[model samples]
Structure formats: structure tokens, C-alpha cells
Target: MKKRKILIIGLMVVGALALLTGCIPGDGSHTVAKPAGFFSGIWHGWIAPISLVGGLFNKHLRVYEVNNTGWFYDLGFYAAVISGFGGISLFRNKKSKND
Candidate 1:
């Protein structure tokens, strides 16, 4: 029980740090460019298509911009949801008639 607590605390700290380092502007002096190979995964790859779909149409030149923003914000939210589940029975969590 104590170990689980500590492990969860550590995961929370790590996740917070990852968010800070990845999203937050560091120092703000440099250009704060995207990290190399940051978008080198299956999830990263979906970002482009998802964002494109998320930003279907607009008169102004804002498709790519909307896509990029949607990619990060939406993907981050989904990642959080997946992590929260801990790969367990989300739908069957409660004591139901089937159980």
C-alpha cells in the first residue's frame, strides 16, 4: 500500500515535469523550438490527421494552426484519460448485475 502511494506520487511528479518541460516556454530567450524526435511515435503521427479533422474548414488561413493546437491539447487530454484507466475495467468498475 505504501509502495503504491509512493509510486503514484512519483508518476504524478514525473508527468508534471514532462508537461512543464515539453509545453512550457523555458527561459523565453531562445526560440523554444520543438524537441528533436518529439513527434516520432504512433500517437504523434495521429496528431496530424486528428488535428486536420478537428479543424475541418475555415475561410481564413488557419487550418494548420488549428490542427497543431488541437493535436497537442486533444492528444494530451486523451493520454491523460488512458493513463487514468491504468489499463483496467473502466466500464465494469462498479458492482453491476453482470458482476
Candidate 2:
């Protein structure tokens, strides 16, 4: 059970990384949030891998929704947070065992 939890935590961290890294290029300093295909800039795709893959399979890709922003940093931040929590838990467990 503990291993499974760790695995799940690790996956969550990885998933967060994936989401953060999947961001599109942001606009230049002079440009507004709008860009090519600007109307469909929502970032729904950054939610999960299965959703992205499923959309690709169906040939009805519904990529991101919000423009002028990348998902990478956001996801990366979340991944770090979760991974840090897991690490803290593991470290505490080890310390407890030693004590």
C-alpha cells in the first residue's frame, strides 16, 4: 500500500511536469494575448495525458483554451510541490524508523 501510494504520488509529479512542459509559445512583449488560432486557446489539454491522447485518437482535438500563457511552469510548480511533500513524508518516515 505504501509503495502504491508512492507510485501514485510520483505519477502525479510526472503528470504535473508533463502539463507544465506542454505549454505553447507565449506572445512577444509587444503582442497581446491573441495569436494564430487564437479563438481556441483554452488549456484544457493540460489536464491529463489520457484526455490529450483520447482527443488525438478521436481526431477531434480540443487543445488549450486560454491564450497568452504557458502551462509548463504551472505544472512544474505543482509537480515540485507534490514531489516535495512525498519526499518530506519519506524523510520523516526514515527519521522515525531510526529513532
Candidate 3:
């Protein structure tokens, strides 16, 4: 029963995604604004995983911008990637009375 329920839910989610994808209107000429500057790079990096998934379904979508301010954008993107992937723990309070 549990397996059947899971399968049904998965199918529903996939169907919804297909429907949404179908709703995207255009002759494939819709251009998404690429992320620029440090802040935008950070934001894009943070959402990179999601962007990657979205990009898989839409050929026009990109996970990272091609044109940016170089080093600053790279730095921000690295920072965001590190922070998003558990690097924030480096600044956490590790001293607990119990330990």
C-alpha cells in the first residue's frame, strides 16, 4: 500500500512538472537575464542546484552566467557555494557546556 501511494504521488509530481513545462510559451526565443555582479553571482550560486535541474528541462536556462565581472563574481559564487554546502558551520558555536 505504501509503495502504491508513493508511486501515485511521484506520478502526480511528474505530471505537474510536465504541465508546467508545457505552459512555457515561445518559439524558444525567451532569453533569461543572466546573473551579473557579486551579489547576483552569490544568489545564482546559492540556487545553482535548482538551476541545474531546471536547466535540464529547459535548454535556455543556465546554472551559471557566462558574462560577469570576473573575479568578484567568482569569489561571490565560491562563497555562496561554500556556505550553501555546510561551510557556514565553521562559524558556529562549537563550545557547549555539555562537551
Candidate 4:
């Protein structure tokens, strides 16, 4: 019973993620300009995983913008992705030997 409950919760979480990630619009017509700027890069990076999944089935999907502000946009995107994935544990409290 415990396993069943866990499985259900996991499935729900996965479904929710899919829904959230799948909402980003793709570029099929190639007319829509790529979003630029720092925040936009962060947003794009935050949703990159979802975009990757979307790209798997859709040729028009893109994980990153091609017309961004060069290095700044890339930096923001990478930073957002790293933070989002917990790559750099920012909230963990350090424990000293005294404690």
C-alpha cells in the first residue's frame, strides 16, 4: 500500500512537470524572434529540460535562443539551470565541529 501511494504521488509530480514544461511555445514558422535579455535567458534555461523533452517529439522546439545577447544570456541561462538543478547547494547550512 505504501508503495502504491508513492507511485501515485511520483506519477502526479511527473505529470505536473510535463504540463509545465510542455507549455512553452515552439518555433515552427521560424518567424517568431528568439527572446533576448538576462531574465529571458534565465527563463529559457529554467525551462530547458522541458524544452529538451519537447524537442524530442517536435522539430520546432528549441532549448535555447539563437538571438540572445551573447555571453550574458548564456551566463544567465547556465546560472539558472545550475541553481534549478541544485548543482550549487546555496541553502544548506554548514555544520562545524563545535556543533
Give the top-scoring candidate (TM-score): 4
- The per-residue C-alpha lDDT of model 3 at residue 15 equals 87
RMSD of each: 11.4, 12.0, 6.7, 4.4
Residues 1-99 of candidate 1 have per-residue lDDT tens digits of: 999999999999988655533322122222325321223222333333433443355233221222333455455545544654443566556787977
State the lDDT of candidate 4 residue by residue for 1-99, as single tens digits.
999999999999999886666435355322236447687678778898888988899887888877667788789889889888886577878799998
Ranking by lDDT: 4, 3, 2, 1
Clashing pairs in 3: none
Which ten-residue region of model 1 has the weakest summed lDDT?
23-32
The predicted structure with the larger lDDT, 2 or 4, is 4
Task: Give each model a TM-score.
Answer: 0.25, 0.27, 0.55, 0.58
Off by over 4 Å in 3: 1-35, 89-99
Give the higher-lDDT candidate: 3 or 4: 4
Candidate 4's displacement at residue 53, Å, is 0.4
What ranges in model 4 sit over 4 Å off?
1-35, 88-90, 93-99
* Residue 68 displacement in candidate 3 (angstroms): 0.7
Off by over 4 Å in 1: 24-99
What is the per-residue lDDT of model 3 for residues 1-99, given as tens digits with 9 covering 90 to 100? Answer: 999999999999988765544412222423355436787668667777766778878786676666666799789888888998878788888998888
Clashing pairs in 1: none
Residue 46 CA error for candidate 1 (Å)? 31
**Candidate 2 lDDT, 1-99, residue by residue in tens:** 999999999999988766654443221221345432321232332333444554565553323333333455345534544554455676563446557
Worst 10 residues of 3 by lDDT: 22-31
